[model samples]
Target: MLRSHDKCVVYIKSDDGEKVVDEIKTFQDAHWVSSPKALWRIYEFNLTEMQPAIINLQLHLPGKQAVCYWKKQNLQSIVESDFVHQTMLTEYFKMCPIDIEARTYLY
Candidate 1:
């Protein structure tokens, strides 16, 4: 289990969001949003535990990158971006999918 200090927000987008959300639900301490988009979902998990989660995403959603996003930074940007109901995460996520995943994995 991930410690409190490791808590972070995760935005998972797959060709199959429902399946991904279902898969994520099996993870410890994961909480999904009440509503889900057709091909994307938002969740929160501990930083350390997320590796396996990403691995699972790769296994199940092959060829898709599992991106990890920082809640506070993006949250600030989300608030500053346009003032919507946290949809900025999804929009920005879609805009820069490679970036979110690359930096997290490479750096």
Candidate 2:
């Protein structure tokens, strides 16, 4: 389903499932990350925090969107670069957005 959108999908499992999903959406709504390199940096930096339950990681190009899913608790987290650090919780949810348009545009 996510693959059809042409956006990067990275799913992650967190201590709190609902909170993580909300956080991801917040970041996506803001329109973050200008390039793919920045997105990769965010993923490498945050990988440690998202461990164990975070079984699957999907990264779609063009859109620079990531969807992170958990294997154990069925938790999902999405992160994009557009989100600003308005609060502590929001700050922690920061991520890079996949450039979906770029992929489709080229294809």
lDDT of 2 by residue, 1-107 (tens): 12322244445558877424454664475434556647767777662364333333332443444434456643322232233113323322332235544333211
Model 1 lDDT, residue 73, Cα: 64
Off by over 4 Å in 2: 16-19, 23-107
lDDT of 1 at 33: 34
Task: At residue 88, give the lDDT of candidate 2.
Answer: 28
**lDDT digits (tens) for residues 13-83 of candidate 1:** 68866423434544444633334331233444342454434431222232233344576566556444543
Model 2 accuracy (lDDT, Cα): 0.41
Clashes of 2: 27
Worst lDDT window (10 residues) for model 2?
A: 84-93
